[model samples]
Target: MSLEVEEARIVIRAGPRRIFGIPTYLNMLGSVKMAPARYLAGVARAEGRPLYAEDPRLRRALEAICSECAAAEAGEGRAVSRAEVVEAYYNALAPQLLSLAPSIDSIVVPCYTGALGEAVARRAEESAPGVALIAVKLGEGGCSWADAVYTAQAVDERLKSLNLGPASLAAISAALKAAEELNLYSTLVVLTDGR
Candidate 1:
């Protein structure tokens, strides 16, 4: 399958606060940076190959239902850490982000496993220095990942006019909330997922 990622940059303004957003779910794959990993897993499954993923989330998500497919594992046979997955995602994501907004002051993103946050911060330092990354920890601080997911879903339901996915809502919510607490300007909210 041909992978094509498309994004729409929008300005979200509340009172004197404003944040730019790029929605990535509009891509042909329906998922943002997760597309490549999922695609590769699909290809392996189609070829009747055993899948291996060190990331528990990915392993569970990509587990095949049929007997022809093998389950993903974090075994001695292979080691694909979550960091590696995030790095690959960031490698593909950075160019698009840099090309779209090379001079943004800050980026607000949702931190799921912390790997994505680290990848974004590292890449921003290497390429786009001076760019601040604000990661809202989703599965930490006594809050379960499920709680964050449900909260994002609620935010999506309320902000239906924005036409964004739950992940996008999470980022946007974090950016807006951060705006209220901190002085943020020329901020870009990485809408990691879109509808």
Candidate 2:
């Protein structure tokens, strides 16, 4: 399938007062910034491109879903965890990705609590046939050690199903270093949140 075509950048922004923001997924994403740019520019770049969000309803849906976080106002009277907030964001965005149906050639697991990270990977594949999915986890990031361990385990189990374009299992920084040394998956596709 021909992948979506565009140029973009995606960043996961954590508010000033919230969970410890982890850049765990950065090493992996930064690793392959060139190869995909040339070969699968459309698909890869599509992830990085800004979203047009023509549908008002979908835009509203996305905003609502992502904003529903474990982090509430000081007096919102709720105990929300980082995981809970990320999970809600993932759930909210899933439908948009589903409806957009960009011919996904690669899936980037950039940022999410462990549960949401795995969920995003699995959901991406389900939504796009013949999709390649890879994840990046920083040694010290937002999610807890327990969250990382469990998310890693779950992701390992699911990766077999995805058709990968590049294969490198290492820390984000190291993986990125190796990619710079060697040549591989060089593109950043921001699947969502480009507005």
Candidate 3:
């Protein structure tokens, strides 16, 4: 499958001024479980490329698939440890995020894994310096890299209001709420998932 990341529209809300939405989840191949990062890692493993997953759940899933793929290939290749797959996924994301930086004051990211937020922040420092980084934690940890961090639960009610009821994905709602809180004329909110 093609590894090229796709772009989502910049959603501008009437009252929120420059709050734009970059829905990263649009790039997801199929189900929510098949997150872009997970898909990238899976493809890498299946192709006998070096990859690693730090999250226990993701690691377990990768291990199961990787073992099967390895056997299919008669164990010809080695799987490298370390977050290579995730890092590459984030690296693929940098260009898109950077493209939005010039037009916005800050970027709000939803952190499912802290690495996700950190990787974006690290990339911003180099290519989009001065643009603020705000992170909303959907899972746990992985938010220290952000200029500020808020928990998913803390923003749930506000998210509901913004989403016009119950929000299906915590990441998208949290991102919108966090951006609204910033009170900026323009903020780029990265919606990490759709479902």
Model 2 regions lying over 4 Å from their true place: 1-76, 81-83, 98-102, 139-188, 191-195
Candidate 2 RMSD to the correct structure: 16.7
> Which residue pairs clash within candidate 3?
114-142
Ranking the candidates on lDDT from highest down gives 1, 3, 2
Winner on lDDT (1 vs 3): 1
TM-scores, one per candidate: 0.66, 0.33, 0.63
State how far residue 68 of model 1 sits from its true place (Å): 12
Off-target runs (Cα >4 Å) in candidate 3 are 1-7, 10-16, 31-82, 153-169, 175-177
- Write the residue-wise lDDT of candidate 2 on 45-129 in tens digits: 3444322222233223322333332122334323334443344434544444444345333333444334444545555656655
RMSD in order of candidates: 7.6, 16.7, 7.4
Give Cα-based local distance difference scores for all models. Answer: 0.58, 0.32, 0.55
Per-residue lDDT of candidate 3, residues 133-182 (tens digit): 88776665567788877665443333333322112334445555666676
Best by TM-score: 1
Per-residue lDDT, model 3, residue 140, is 52
lDDT of 1: 0.58
